[model samples]
Target: MKYTEILEVVRQYIEQFYDAKEDSTLTFHNFAHTHDVVTHATKMAKHYGLDERETFVVTTASWFHDTGYYTGEANGHEQRGAEMAGGFLKNLGVKEELIQEVQKCIMATVMPQKPENLLQQIMCDADLYHFGTEQFSERNMLMQEEVERKTGCKIDNNNWRKATICLLESHFFKTGYGRELLEYGKKKNLERLKRKETRGMMRKSHIPNSCLGE
Candidate 1:
């Protein structure tokens, strides 16, 4: 299939499905995030010299990935998203082989990502491109809010900062294209997060003597 045709199909799918089942609580996994992934995936596909068919698969998978968050299930959203993508694409007359590849691309985006090939690697890195950008902190805050709302358990600043630090230190873009494009920003973002975490710890330890019942 031509790129324009499949791209439009993927766009329409996102608009209709997301509108019908949009979860207001999923601040971080909403349409904007999906769009970002698709945009980044396209860039990486071009950089990696993906053929037309491979580009189609990557874009389709990116569009439908994380859709299962609308289902209100915290765990296994990747598998659920893959299943949703399979059914939708199959209904659109997409070949079984293409649909399965698309599903694999979607599944490969799960955290601690394990991409088995170039296509999967591109999509996985695109899915997490925000981790290395100036918008990382803004997106990070939205993620924190979503977690707090969904779990109904407040995560204090210190705990959240520590967890965020660990995640940034552990995360990396899988593809060479991704690393060359994002590694500097990723390291900068990590430094910013480390400083933030340290400041948070210091704040917690700095108790004022005025409140000591003197």
Candidate 2:
């Protein structure tokens, strides 16, 4: 089958897979997030003028990169996702070479993303594209909500901000396109978060000791 046909099949399969196993706790890593990653991957692929086969590899990987979230564990979702992609593609008669490429792309999205090639770098940047966009705030909140819901613990707002700031500070866009187009926006978002954290601390400092039962 053509790569386009194969990609369409993968898309449908992933959609159905998520639909069949609905989990409300997956506020962030659901079909919507997968679709967004695919969209961002496509955009970056196009920016780099990737050929049809390369585009297919990156796009297909995006579709399956988070499938393992459905398996009820986020710890090693990237490995599980790569396995799922390989198995599904193998069943579809995809060549072993292409299947491995797709698996590599998916694995590149693992935390502290370590992408060794351009395609892997595209996948990594696409997965965290929101971190550099205007949608960062909304996406970040959904992720926070998902984490709290899954762990059954209310994360303190100040602590969440601190963690988010650390992430923003540590993250860098791997692709040139990402650095050129998204880096400024990411810095702006980081500044906004820092300001919020500062205001939060100031507010707490102004509170009376009596209110703290001291």
Model 1 segments beyond 4 Å from truth?
Answer: 208-214
**Model 2, 1-214: lDDT tens per residue?**
5988998999899989999979999999999999999999999999899999999999999999999999858999999999999999999999999999999999888889899999999999999999899999999999999999999999998899999999999999999999998999999999999999989989988999999788
Give per-residue lDDT, candidate 1, residue 194: 85
List TM-score per model, in order: 0.93, 0.97
Q: Which stretches of candidate 2 lie over 4 Å from their true place?
A: none
- RMSD after Cα superposition, model 1: 2.2
Give the alpha carbon lDDT tens digit for every residue of 73-105 in model 1: 979999989999999888888899999999999
Q: Which ten residues in a row have the lowest lDDT in candidate 2?
A: 70-79
